[model samples]
Target: MTDTQDELPQLMSHQSFREQAREVIRGMIVSGKMAPDALYSAPKIASDLNVSATPVREALLDLVQEGLLRPVRNRGFQVVIMTAKEHDDVFKIRLLLEVPSIREIAKSSPTANQMKGLYDLANAARQFAREGDLIAYLNADRRFHISLIELLGNKPLTELVASLRDRVRLLGLANSGARSHIVQSATEHFELLDRIAASDTESAAAIIERHLRRSRDVWGAGSGPA
Candidate 1:
């Protein structure tokens, strides 16, 4: 009898807008435009994104569920950053899951079309990095890595890896002054693909191992551990 909007949430027609707002805000947080120390209001974010407040509210609530943010009652939400130990643990888990798995991709018969698409994403990622657009860079980088993981044909594995990636808190990447490191990291994508194409499994694995390490060691460099 209490199945009203008062007792349960509803998914209305504005789902796409909510998703858009969520992705944009998430990108901002991940890119370091929104610091963990600050509180952000849905109305304010909607104003900045030029959207209605309702969708932004829904998006903000979603982020709360994902643990990227904490609700601040009437004020808004505060960004949540992972502890150094948590970040380090996530990095170790990713290393275990991603590095060796790359060998399977290198051994598989990936189509030329697939490789071309990945190369395009790699180039886009590189350009985004060079321009210092951390949001765009992370977007492209996420897609590149996820796409590579998808080639393994394991949906659960793909989802697990993606979830792990999402667990990373924003490390203020935009102001990290990691210009040289990011550029070098972006270029590593191409090297990964090249190794995959050559069927050099061990080499691909090594590249990815180093690549994964840098996220914990260098992506947020000059900050605290991990």
Candidate 2:
């Protein structure tokens, strides 16, 4: 086949190519495949993903809006390096929102279905931890938190918290020693679940605060703040 013909598949498909590029690049950034402070462009990434430049540019733009990336002057996009302060800031906001939300949820009490869903999520996190799957563990952890806030039935709040969680993940703060740290973090989920299930909002709030503070310290050490 000619060069042009050979590149046909690389062109945009009828599917959501933009979303695909976004997800692919996102995976690279969050997985540490694309190091922080590294610079890339739409064309460069397009070659990597075997897609056209249009969708790649669109995808990068989306991440820029999400605070995961920044646009360069004449170059492509730069992976925004997240500092320790940024992580702490996000965690502080999480503490503010999550603590009160959990307290409210505790007061109202979780229904049987909500309780079951949370247990399932916590179990998934534990399973991922045992298997040494950091990405899966983080995903399960995010879901657990998001699902709890979802109990409030506030769409905007849920979206903001989820966005902050994603940004935090990109900071490479989830790194840990081994199965032990993973297991400990995942176990904390079950403990928190127990509190919420029992409608102990006060205790749950305290747990939530301590969990976040401990995570901030541990992850801060791994990332070294800068």
Candidate 3:
């Protein structure tokens, strides 16, 4: 069968472009560039990012599936905003899941390659944080933490943790007052890796706890409940 003229539009559905659009849009949402409950149209987003609307729409639908966005009738997608109580509940659950998981992760003695990959991610996050690029920092930060959790060999758990991490409302993360704390936390990613490398499970768990609390207190600050 010969290709139809309609197939030209299909060019917009390229896998790499779709995935890139998805990640970029997701970063914008989670890094607090897209305010919660605000409606954003695919065309507007596409125009801003210099991409075709096709992949932008597809990306919006993907975020909707992730529960990060809600589709409005012929309008656009709204960022999903959680109540203060809901945010706190997610925070508590994250603490429960992540802190203990570090113990298991630390016992494994990650391969050198795994450690190197994580270090690269951690360094990227720190560098971005220092550069005041919240979006880039968030992407690297998510990967670094998720990589450590994956060492436990539990895909389900890793996905759950990642979803919860993304669900958080980081309202004040970009504030000047929060920059120091952000950098400190970014630096501590290395400390967490070190503790895990040394098999100091308790120490690693402590670092994880402190990290989560800062996330809850600093980034999530003014996001709702005190």
Candidate 4:
């Protein structure tokens, strides 16, 4: 019993480290820091993260299940290349999920905690935008959207949309015109949040559609399987 109890905290710590590594690696792949069609080793990534290989390897395996990376025999993992159609498909899914959801959120009026969380996320995205930290910006953006959608209490739907978002981000859309317009995009998020807080369902829905379309234009143009 003592041995089991002692191992429990270590297991939880490893799980926490694995999740952090997954987020860092995901942001790297999304921001074009980790190019597609390349193999990266667990030991090297572990060294960079200053963590043991166990957690890093576990994190890499988690990404493999997410369709972002694939395992190689001896090599660590290869970033998966996404085609233009695949990118479009992911956006389409987002549009399908988020548009109506935002309308609902506006009608329901967010709770105090939800309002605070949304504000924090929007502010973080805006700050990262001003700082030109593309990866952090994307991470904040993803969390903002996921938190927005999760208000509906649909776990499966949230997971599905989040997976699509990961696929879209891995396309390196933030590396192009999207980077130049980071502030603009972040501002749009702020506006959408304001509208939601005001219970302006129609306007919030409109903002959601326009925001996503602008992202598609900025990131989707001239990008294909790489």
For lDDT, candidate 1 versus 2, the one ahead is 1
Estimate TM-scores for all models.
0.85, 0.77, 0.88, 0.89
Question: Candidate 3, which segments miss by more than 4 Å at Cα?
Answer: 1-15, 170-174
Q: Kindly give the stretch of ten consecutive residues in candidate 3 with the minimal lDDT sum.
A: 1-10
| lDDT, model 4, position 208 | 96
Query: Each model's C-alpha lDDT?
Result: 0.77, 0.76, 0.78, 0.81
lDDT of 4: 0.81
Q: What RMSD does model 4 have? A: 7.1
User: In each prediction, how many residue pairs overlap at the backbone (N, C-alpha, C within less than 3 A)?
Assistant: 0, 1, 0, 0
Cα-lDDT of candidate 1: 0.77
Error of 1 at 132 (Å): 2.2
Residue 88 CA displacement from its true place in model 2, Å: 2.4
Top candidate by lDDT: 4
Over 37-151, each residue of candidate 1 has an lDDT whose tens digit, in order, gives: 8878888777666668999899999988877788998899988877767767877899999987898899895899999999999999999899976667777888889999999
Best by TM-score: 4
Better of 1 and 3 by TM-score: 3
